[model samples]
Target chain A: MSASGRRRSQKYHQSTPYLFIAPFFLLFIPFGAGSVLLALGMSFVDWPLGQSPELVGLDKFATVLEDPLFGRAMRNTLYMLVGFLLALLPLCLLVAVLLKQLRRRTANVVQVVIFAPITMSLIAVALVFDLLYNERVGFVNGILDMIGVGPVPFLSDSDLAPWSIIALRIWRVLGYYAIILFAGLQAIPDEFYEAAELDGAGAWQRFRHVTFPLLKPVTMFVLVASSIAAWELFAEVDVLTDGGPARSTLTAVMYIFGASFEQFDLGKGAAASVVLAFAIIVSTVVAHRLLRSDDRA
Target chain B: MPKGSFAGRMGRGTVIGLIVIVTAFPLYWLLISSLKPSTRLGEVSLIPSSVTLGNYVAAFDTQIPRWMLNTFGIALLTTLLGVVVAALAGFGFARYRFRGRSLLFGVVLASLAIPEYALVLPQFTIMRQFGLLNTWAAVILPLAANALVLFLLRQYFSQLPEELFDAARLDGSGEFRLFWTIAVPLVRPGLGAAGLLLFLNAWNAYLLPLVMLTNSEQFTMPIGLAFLHSQLNFGIVEKSPWGAITAGTVISIVPLILCLLVMQRQFIGSLTAGAVKA
Candidate 1:
């Protein structure tokens, strides 16, 4: 090709990348980053529905902070997050380890069976759990009755409602996370376990020494991802309890939802959302740091 | 005991059996109860003596059919638009060395950390401002710009050998033709994976649609079902709505379940791949 022709083609190549990439930026700028900035701006102003916005600076945040219901929502979310991580981490780990022990065919079937729940809609899953937790016609209460135990108020009692909601969340997500960890486990060669056995390490020692450390990256991924999901708890609670039974299951998102939509207090909702986003970021950073510190050690 | 020993095998079998049953029983109950008489919802029996298709018939009479169509249309549009844009962007990032490329890519990845809840209110305001509220576009537009899909496809495109592109370019192939014909076909699996994620995310999305859509006709399956559930629980609907709920639940989930069964490898593979990379 001639020098001018080559120059033109080179220029075309330079511009082509921009043309290819422009579409994503076009949508993302107006929606993704734009929405976040808009939320940040909205958080500082008192924008009641159908009314002109008034800049209230940090007062909206202060109101959100002082609101007893927001406090409860955060507390409930934290309580459930702890319980959820406590239960889910070990259970999924156990499932992943046992899955590693099984033959490939058997493991695949078992994995699919357990992984099915994550595919189903949360609303449907919540409805199924609601029925199962029903006092009169539920299968769970029926079993409890046969065992001479009174029916459990899974969603009705404030104390149990959060845990009940957590259980449903765990059930839906267990296999999904476990499958991710299972893939992680599959990456750990059998040589490590065999070497541990040859060194007179028992199963527990093998796990403690060999499995846990190697699985840390995947485990950390699970920790951060699941905790983020835990923090954003809404749909399960919304469908199951509507943050009901004395607002026991009122998640941060639900509080935000109620404030913004039900009450039409967009500023308060935006403020609460800002707080929630900060919490999520801080927690994720903390988790990353904690895992990194352990990795160093 | 050793793994293959009798006690170990028995223990493993028992654990597997329990896990399968616990994980699967609720779905089983859902299927069975939907087939049972709606009037007998209070019955706690494990099995119904008689089966009826009445619940499904009753469900069809509701707005569920419309909700399903709305959700399907929205999810499909989101997937189609999301994948095309992502594919282009992914190819750009992988194959090009442009100014501010890293910064631009960083911006895209950073958006992943912003939870949907944080954006929903502002997105609602934007949609309302544009007079797009209560329309299918309201749901599809925001969801179509999915950062995760962009990230996943970028990872896929980055793995391709540059020699192929170079050879094609030397053959006087146009940039668009090279991407559309050579690069895209090479990354077909990635496209499938990205497409599946986008579709499922849009299909199962509740918060965005719930915030943007007020009319029942525009509600997605999740919102529609949640509405039905709340109505029944609050006693707004005195008659049995359990049948409709259960039947709707089944109809809503069956297609995705079938999709999972068929594409089990891709479903599991792509999810794991994304996490591992993340």
Candidate 2:
């Protein structure tokens, strides 16, 4: 081949890959990359919508830090996060293990039933839960009435509302996470279980030694995913309680949405969201390190 | 073990059964409530004395069909645009070694950790600046560039046999032809899965649409239902919107249910496939 033709071929080869991949970067750079930087920049300026922007430096962060609602929001978020993880991890793991032991047909049916909620929109779920949590004539109160107990205000009560929201989240995600963990279980080599049986290990011991340890990666995945989701709680609270009776279910994300969109305080809202993002990052990092470091120690 | 005692098996069955019932009761209630007459309001009975289709009529009157149309358009377009772009990029990344490839791929992966809401402020601002706010483009453009789909497709495409690519190239097929013909069709499962994931994500999206679109005319199904819910006077109206809300909820979710029924295995597998592996 001529040298000019070889160089032309090289040129075609070099640019072809870029042409193929350009669409991703083209959209990503402006939207994804630019959005992050814009959010960061917006966090610094006291820029409400349709107003003169004032450079506030760390003032916006300070305002978020000092705001009592911010604290309450953070607290409520953590409350849901902790409660959700506590309910989710063990229950999902148990369900996944149970699913593993089930006959294929039964497991498929159960998996679909369990996972049905995850496919449903959260707004719808929250709306259903709202009706179910009504102080009067709610199915829940009806159940309580059947047991000769007085009507208990599920959402009206401050302490119970967050838990109720957490329950809704747990209900939505438990089966989905279980399916993920069940996939993890299926991926586990059969030899390990056989080896454990050969050692005369009981079922619990077999699960404890062979299943739990091997499922660490997936457990960690669920941990971070659910935790991030809990941190970003909005639609559920918005629909169920609207941050509720006395701001009980007012999560960080909800507060951010209300501040930015409703109140139009763009700067503070951005700062609050950045802080929430930081919290998610910190928690995910801490959780991941804890999970990884366990293998070492 | 499969050889567990009868009582133990029964106990396990009962536990799982109770859990499923509790978890699914609200949905069942929603269905039954949608079918019930307004006279049966607040009745906690599992079955209604008389089922009425009035609520569905009310629900449809509330512009739900429009909302559903909007939602379906956005989700479908997002899925199509996202899957196609991601497929091309995936194929590129998989087949050809290029300059700064790892750096670009790394950036895409890193973007995964950034939750959608975290960047809402700037994303909103960007939409405003581009005059895309309130338009479907505001939601569609940002959503179409999903890192998850890109990553999943890249991985799937890479696993395809290299020999196929070589043979295709030797047959004098150009890169674009190779990608459109050889790569995409071969990764049809991956494409379908990724498309479905994108569709579902866009369908269930709330925050973006909530912030983006101002007009009720442009509202997606979720937001429309939410508005209907909020406006519902809880059986006070001559024809209560509660039943309509329930019916709307059922209508909105029916597509998802159909999607699940149609692609149960692929849906579950594609979603969880990368969960632990990452």
Candidate 3:
């Protein structure tokens, strides 16, 4: 074909793809990217509720730095992140490994039940957990009663509120994470296991040498995703604790929310949000880089 | 390995069975609690000796039905709009080589990393500016374009053979017709997967609805449940009806459980596909 003919055909071809993609960019320009830009612009000014917006250039960031609540929220976020990593990740991995050993039919049934909670609304989970955490009539208290132990303050005490949130997070995410890990496990060719078996490797040895190494990418992905997720934990806190009993579960997202909406301190809220987003992005980037290097090695 | 010995296999089976039971206990509890009479909700019984449907009855009488309707409407809208929009965008990114494609793709991926809460305030402000607060549009409009769904669809679309598109074009069909009849059918599995996710997300969405909808009539199930909790006066003198709350909790999760059961395979496949990607 001649160059002009080829150009004409290419133009028509390219038009189709662009037309197909227009909806996403059209929506995103207004909602996603536009909102982020607005937030960034809002962060620099003293944009309080019902007040004229004033540019305060870094003052809000300075104020957020001095605010004790900001510190407390950050601390709580870290606590929850650590709790999820320490408790949830291992439990999910263990469950996935165990499920992988089961018969296919049985595992399917178990997988459905396990993944059910992930789809359940956080509000529903919170309500159910609220019942479970009820001081007098909760199922947990009922169980404690059978054991002749005093009722543990699941959502009441500030000291224990974070743990309660963590418990809920674990329950909600374990199955989904386990499914992800199991996918990673399945991707490991059966020949690898067969080869290990020929070498007289035991199950534990096979797992350690084969499964764990192969599952690293999924594990890292889960770690970063879950950490970011745990940090942004809001619905459960809002519905269950309301960051209450002394603001024990006042996550960074909650703090940003209160600052923006409740207090109408948009500048401070934007500042906090910017900081939180930066922290997540940086941590995610660092983790990815480290994992990539390990992969290379 | 001689079947790994009967004793060892038995022990492993017992452990696996125990894990499955423990894992499913909360859902089982939800079902049992839902079935119990409203009065026996907190009576510390695993099995309800006498089951009553009054709580479900009460739920219907209260705002539960309205909440369910609102949730259903919004979720369906969000899923349909989100899937259609995402599928187009995903197809674009997968098949096209255009100006700024990489940059645009990066923006979409970045949006996935940007927490929804981070955008909620600005989104709320924008919605307020447009007088959309307390409306379903406020809830559905912002969610119409989901980066995760787009990314999933893009990956799925990219797996299709180029020859299919060529074959369709040779037949002189237009782009839209080709996509509608050929591309869509080919990507139905991906659509089903993305639809399940989008539905679950919209249904379970709390923070967006909580902030967007001010009226009780507009409240979704999660917000409605929260309102119910707040309404229960558990003061020193007044006692909360734990049975009713338990019943309410059970009612809220039933639809989600049903949806999962109906689309269990696709849901599992969608989840595992992303993780297993090389």
Specify the highest-lDDT model's number: 1
Per-residue C-alpha lDDT of model 2 across residues A61-176, encoded as one tens digit per residue: 99999999999999989988898899889999988988887888888888888878888888988877866877654778877888899688888789988888888888899899
Model 2 over residues B175-218: C-alpha lDDT tens digits?
79878888888888888778878988899999999999989999
lDDT tens readout by residue for model 3, A1-297: 444465434624657777888887887887899999988888899987767779989999999989999999998888888877899878888888877877888788889988888888888888777768878667888888888996888988998988888988888888888988888887899899999999999989998789988989899978887888887888888877888879888889889989988998988998999889888888889878877787666
Give, for candidate 3 chain A, the lowest lDDT window spanning 10 residues.
A2-11
Q: Check candidate 3 and list the clashing pairs.
A: none
Q: What number of backbone clashes does candidate 1 have, counting pairs of residues 3 or more apart or in separate chains?
A: 0
Q: Model 1, B59-174: lDDT tens per residue?
A: 99999999999989999999999999999999999888899999999988898898888999998888889999999999998999988888999989999998897788777788
Evaluate model 3 with DockQ and give the value: 0.60
Top candidate when judged by DockQ against the true structure:
1
Model 1 misplacement above 4 A: A1-11, A146-148, B236-238
Between prediction 2 and prediction 3, the one with superior lDDT is 2
Candidate 2 chain B, poorest ten consecutive residues by summed lDDT: B232-241
Native-referenced TM-scores of chain A, all candidate models = 0.95, 0.94, 0.92
A1-297: candidate 1 lDDT, tens digit per residue = 644478633634568899999998888988899999999999999999778889999999999999999999999899999999999999999989888888888887887788788888778789888778877667788788888997898888999988888888889999999999989988999899899999999889999999999999999999999999999989988887888899888889999999998999999999999999999999999999988898778
Better of 2 and 3 by TM-score: 2
Worst 10 residues of 2 chain A by lDDT: A2-11
